[model samples]
Target chain A: MTPIELRCCGQGGQGVIMTGMVVGKAAAIYEDRHATLVQSFGPEARGSTCSAQVMISDAPVPFPYVRHADILVAFSQSAYDKFVAELKPGATLIYESDLLSLDNRLPQGVVARGIGATRIATEVLGRRIVTNMVMLGFLVKQTGIVSKEAAIEALRTLVPPGTSAFNIKAFETGYQQPPE
Target chain B: MTKREAQPLRTGLHFMNGNEACAEGAIAAGCRFVAGYPITPSTEVVEHLARRFPRIGGMFIQMEDEIASSICFQGAVWAGHKAMTVTSGPGLSLMMEHIGFAAMTETPSVFINVQRAGPSTGLPTAAAQGDIMQVRWGSHGDYAIIALCPSSPQECFDLTIEAFNLAERYRCPTFLMMDETVGHMMGKVRIPDAADLTVEPRRNTTRAPGDYQPYATYDGSDVPEMTRAGDGHAIHVTGLTHNEKGYPDMSFAVHDALVRRLQRKVHTHTSELFRLEADGLDDADVVVVAFGITAGIAAYAVTQARALGRRVGLLRLITLWPFDEARIRTLTANARAVIVAEMNLGQVCLQVSRAVQGRIPVHHIGNPGGPVIEPEEILAAIEGAAT
Candidate 1:
């Protein structure tokens, strides 16, 4: 199978890099595949544009960065506007519904899905910081590029001490969201 | 004189960044002291060592500056410890004088330069292969140094160990030349068991104190056996022209012999020091030469060119210094042309040209530094070379 390329973009501190790390770890450590993650590094502080690129394959990933993403994940309006055009045709574009008002303009054969990740984290998980967890769960549900068990195993190994339970719960809630 | 029990190495598959893996490699290779000032891209290496040293039996000092950090590790080496310092381009510039100091004193130590774009602090967080030439010629005077370039997190872990071993074996400064992309990118690295690892033991003198000469080799080898301070041996270490006693002789003959030996110790070992990874070279028309992160990009492009039915191959340089001119000449003898792909405009590319000796056309595909060279860009170069 062709390797799956992904780009996750958002403001710094929104766990954009962490989202990529989780999937990379899941594919590399849990699923016994090759994965490479490269994050954008800059002088930007909290609210600036931050992104992470991840490539997963059965063979070793030669080019570390994603050139044209098979999946584009945007957590804010600016991120969606910036990265949506780079998605391959028939690629999936996932975004946070509450943060973006999509103009409904997408590349050819692109599929768009929006989840209220922030609302779900705040309302269901009682913590807005778990928003990336919600999106990660939904990403696994929609793409199935990485197995759900592998992702949860990655989250359990990577998250801070005593925070895995809450983050996994946030992830499950997003995973169970009905198709709209 | 009681020996401490060996600490267990972290053996197994691990998902980590290149810098973190380098730190683990250092520990596994018996590096117990690190003196470094924090710098971007390379800071995580010392950071990981700082957190790890306390738990194990070692020391990590945040020195006043890169100069202090560089020479400070040399001091640790003299005091009987395997030590190292980590930094990027700008910090590496500050450490040049001490790098010369280590060379002069025959210090067995490792210096890791996770290169960033620079004439001076050009890009702190961006990747570059700009320092390929500097690590060899940065320090003043005519002394040879060993430098290794690693393309992935796994090689980062493995080559860091090899760097330390080369330093120990040759009794000279060795370098792990990493760039921002390989240093920051995360991948899976498998560390082997401690028993399975081959570590070169430090060559210390067994001669009695009164009979021991600090710079004199008992055998025909140019490398002298070493003895740490307070090891019941009278020893002198300095940068000025010195004799077998390591004292300042300040004579032309003494200086010539000392300098020649310093260069010969590593220069004569070129066969053992040079490392190159050849892929699909047996049946290829064009060969791509690259190192560090650019090697990975070039390898991907080679695969693409193969699908297009071009007989292109890859020659990845794992060892940068003691440039493998002989191997490059032999490997590309059958090829139509050689293309050098790197992040810097033209550093190692020139070396390849010199090795090829106008036997075939040599082309370079590079940029000013920072943004990575895409696979498509390298693929285009392969096509150009093939035709």
Candidate 2:
């Protein structure tokens, strides 16, 4: 009964879809965990609003979705609004500072944290959507559902041959962010 | 958060998708030619082999559409080579006519449909367990379908091998009812060495190649080995009703004998082809029955329910068609209630209702829009049955 319900939310152009795929795949292939990755798309695949969910567990994970999340990652203000209600009282919520607004009250039971993901993306990594991978970095730091080495290996296999350097750097920048 | 860890490593693993594993499995099972189209979820089945074929001296052809994709392979199969084609729901629709033709022609071929959302375009990337009945009934007239459904990536790899074997052994078209989740989802697929696999070759029944009739029935098996064009076998195959001698027949004798043999080859030999799973039935009050991705979830629900002092068990279907009627009859004999869940709107539920003959009430849970059914929801259904 591992924490198998994972919901990831981000606006258009963010790599929310990729994050869900990596997490779902890592849970299933690397961890030998049962996993289901589900995503909804907008007008355009790359630049439209999108969200993804991954269910991972040692036991067979039923269905491909969750009524409540064990973990939630939001990269924008809209993401928080759309996904906040799905959180259980004690679930973990990670939000990016530059693109996210923390003013909204979380449900009485959930834990909320601010991760400066977009700032790190634009300043440290010099990109925006890499914020999605940065959120993944923090997720692994928070849950350890997948080892950094395993994620990297999954990235190597998932990402094309040439883009690994930029992705690895973006991921590490988020990995080192101080937990709030 | 600590490094997410689990039980000790199982050592051997290949980080691959179900479609890729299917192709590798086909290769391992000695399939030499593949024809398929690029339909979402199913596209990977051809994609993996497309890259693998030429490298290993096999043939991979991306046909114009699923109709050609399926029919083309029948010719390859007739050429005395093992062949297969993969597609999703809509493509399978295009293939039904040809599938029946293959049945009438007695050409051995395998059709792998990674089922998607139904009656139309449906969901492109979503997972649904529909198409159970469509695969059984879409093709016209009375014929038999030997269908196998795999629950995991490893099974996806292994069952593709089984699909080919059954195709050749029965000399009828076989099917792999793969759905989206299992097709594209990556998992720990163990690639067993090729040498370790037991492969079957195409059965050949040619009597000097000059006087060979393609539709002759072999004793006991009721299926005649197929001989192809230019082998001088004068192979005659048409979708129209034909007699054992490969000629048209509307007379009762040929019609009755030909149709019965097609059904008998599968139903009479059901034990040799059908596969299923049963748990908690030894002394259970409520049982969860599911197939494809839903089976994985139901398995977990059984564990949770049993831990909560509930008598819950699971029955997972690995072979979808040729309905395992005997197993269903025994499992439902003393059960308090049975819940059958799939991704579609009660296709298999109809089959289950017929099998039990209304002895027990069968509840239905379906998501027609390509969504996976949740475990907690299934758990509730199991609990609901108890009270």
Candidate 3:
């Protein structure tokens, strides 16, 4: 399989950072590839740009960050505007419509999808934390870099001390919810 | 009695980051104390040592800044303890004055720099080789320093321990120059039982109290035997120019003798100190020289070049400053061409070029920022040399 280079961008309180970790860990431990994760968080933990990169290669990866990415996941308008330029010619972009404006010229040779992640998390899952999981579900559906099962397993391992089932509900809400 | 056998040790495999490995390295090398500031790329080192120090009856502290961090470690070392500090580019720059202090006082210490990209805050959580020149000439005066570069996670763990041992043997502060690739990397690190490692202690000047001269050479190793601060042997410590008596005397005679002794300590002890590796040069007409993470890729390029019927070899530099001049000069002299590849905009490559002169065409692949050089590009340089 051709390796997948992914970049996740959203505000600080979102589980967008966790999305990158789940996919990166799944690619490494489950798919048996060399995986590298690099992350940067903004000044405040509440409402700031938080971004992370995950690179998976069948061979050893030399550099940690990518010049361009094969997939870019943006959960906010600031994020989409910030990193859409970093996507290469044949990249795919998934945006959260509850928070973004998408009127720019869609770059040739790339695909874009907008999903209402907040609606599914608040209405279906009855929690706000599962919103990122809703978006993550679409990512697996689109790329299959990780199975739905493996990504959930990643969440179970990565979440805080006592918050596994809430995250799993978030995942189910995301997996069942559809885009507008 | 060897210290390794003195303690029955247990070893196990664990997935760990580079920072954890460095802390473990210091502990294994008998470093009983650590003081550092909590900075990205280096915070994990402090935390691990802090956790393990209590178990082993050592000390770890999160100090105010790099200056304090540097001095605190030196203070511990002077009190007859193996001490170290971990920092990155800016922090290393801040500690340079004390680095000069360590040089002047002939204090034996170890410093690990988990380097991040920057002139000033370029990227906090990123990798960089921007500190090469700083490591060589950062201190205010003329002194020779020992630096070790490890490319893989395993080497980071091993070389860090070796760095502390070397410092203790020679009573000089050694540098473990690690960039982000190895610093944040996670891999299977097989730590051996304590019996598998050889340990060395600091040279003691207080063998007998009255005869102790802090700066006097015991084995003629250019390194003087050192007495701890409270050994009641009356050791003098200062950053200013000092004589054999360890008092600040501003005489030209004292300054010249002291500076020369510090320089000669690492410089004259060359063969035992320099660390480098040579590959495929036995039948090579061209050579590719690299250091740190770029060295691994360049080696792959050389392998492919040989398969394609070209004589290309690799000279990997694990030591910077003392420059690995002896072996590199010989390796470049035999090859018809030499190419220097690195992450910076030709910093170390310039050093390599100056060392080789015009004995061979030293082609340089310059990358100032982002994206490591591809193997094919290095192979292209090798093929370009062959033509």
Candidate 4:
């Protein structure tokens, strides 16, 4: 299979790296594909921009960093602004509707989907940190790049103990949302 | 010394970073002591060790500086424990003197340098292969050391164990030369059962106390048997040129013998020390030689070049030191040209060029610092070399 590059980004506290880890594990460990995830490392504080670039392929990923993003999951306005231009033509954009206001000009042939990830996460799960998982669930449903079972299994293994069930609930809630 | 029961291995498939995998590798290799000063791109190694070592009957100390960290683990080694220390470029700089000390004392120890770009703290969070030469000749001395470059998290796990084994086998400072990218990249690593693993037991002397000498070569073995502190052997460990008894000897003859023996112990095992992976060099016109993260990128470029009907191949260096010049010469003997790609400004490229010996045009593709070299650039070099 051709390699697919996904850029998952948000502020540091939004579980951006964890989102990438879950997706990477799902594809690499569960789905029998090779995946490499390179997270942004630096003086990234809680409210600063943080990103995880993931590449999944049938063979081992040669280039660990994302060049042209096939899918972009933006959890904050700054993240969307920072990475939107790198999306490939005819690529998919999954963004948090409550956090990002879509710009007028996007790349040609782009398909964009926005979800109120933070709102649903806070209102339904009573935890804002689960927003990234909600966004991940929407991504899995929309792209089908990884199986639902694969994503759930990956989530169980990656997230901190005692919080997997709640995160899975958030994921399911996002997965069940209408495909408008 | 009695053989201890192996630490229970975390044997299974799991997703982890290179640093985390390295820490697990150390545990699997029976490295019971670690002293480290935390630094970016390498901090995770010690952090993981700190958390895991306490539960596994191991020790992890956060030393005040890299100088202390480097030598602290050697003390543990002398105390009959397999040991390691973790650091990055700046930390490695501070530990240079101790590295030479380890070399002189013939201490079996592992030094993990998760390299970032630097003459000095150039880019703490970014990756580079800058330390390639420094690691080889960093410490002041005429000595040979073994260094391994791991391309991914899996190799990071595998090579760390190899590092310890080689350290014990040769009684020298063995290095796991990792980069920031590999250290931070998350991938799947499969750790095997402890029983299936091949750990090199410490080469401890079995002779009675008074008859044993720390630096005496017995029979055909070039490396001498070691006795730990408190083992009732009157072993004198010193940085000075020592004789068979390991005491300070000022004579040039003694120094020459000691140094040659030290170098010969590793050089004689060059066949085993050399680890390489060569792909598609059978009838290739151009071969790309790379190590660490650059090898993966070069492989991708080789694939692209092959798709374009170019005769391109890739040779990855697994063990960086004890430079396998003969193998490199033999492998690329038929190729038209060679390309050396690395993140540094032509460190390994110089070595490759020397090995090629002006037989073929050795093209170098290098980046001074962060953000790895692009595959297109490497492919371009391959195509150019082929033409």
Query: All models, DockQ values?
Result: 0.78, 0.33, 0.11, 0.73
Q: After superposition, how far is residue A83 of candidate 2 from its true place, in Å?
A: 2.3
DockQ winner between candidates 2 and 4:
4
The TM-scores, one per candidate, come to: 0.96, 0.87, 0.75, 0.96
The whole-model C-alpha lDDT of candidate 4 against the native structure comes to 0.90
Give the deviation of candidate 4 from the true structure as CA RMSD.
2.7
Model 2 spans with C-alpha error above 4 angstroms? A24-36, A39-46, A56-64, A103-105, A108-111, B1-12, B122-127, B205-213, B232-234, B243-251, B300-304, B375-380
Better of 1 and 4 by DockQ: 1
- In model 1 chain B, the worst 10-residue window by lDDT is B1-10
Docking class of 4: medium
- lDDT tens per residue, model 3, B58-154: 7788899999999999988888898988998889989998888887888887889988778776677667777888887998878877888877665
Best by DockQ: 1
> What fraction of the genuine interface contacts, i.e. the true contacts, does candidate 4 reproduce?
0.70
lDDT score, candidate 2, position B152: 72
What TM-score does each model's chain B reach against the true chain B? 0.97, 0.93, 0.94, 0.97
Clashing pairs in 2: A62-B297, A63-B373, A89-A109, A89-A110, A144-B4
Q: Quick one: ranking by TM-score, best first? A: 1, 4, 2, 3
The TM-scores, chain A only, for the candidates as listed are 0.95, 0.90, 0.90, 0.95
State in Å the error of residue B301, model 3: 6.6
- Give candidate 4's TM-score: 0.96
Q: For model 1, how does the per-residue alpha-carbon lDDT over B63-98 read when each residue is reduced to its tens digit? A: 999999999999899998999999999999999999
Task: State residue A2's C-alpha deviation in candidate 1, in Å.
Answer: 3.2
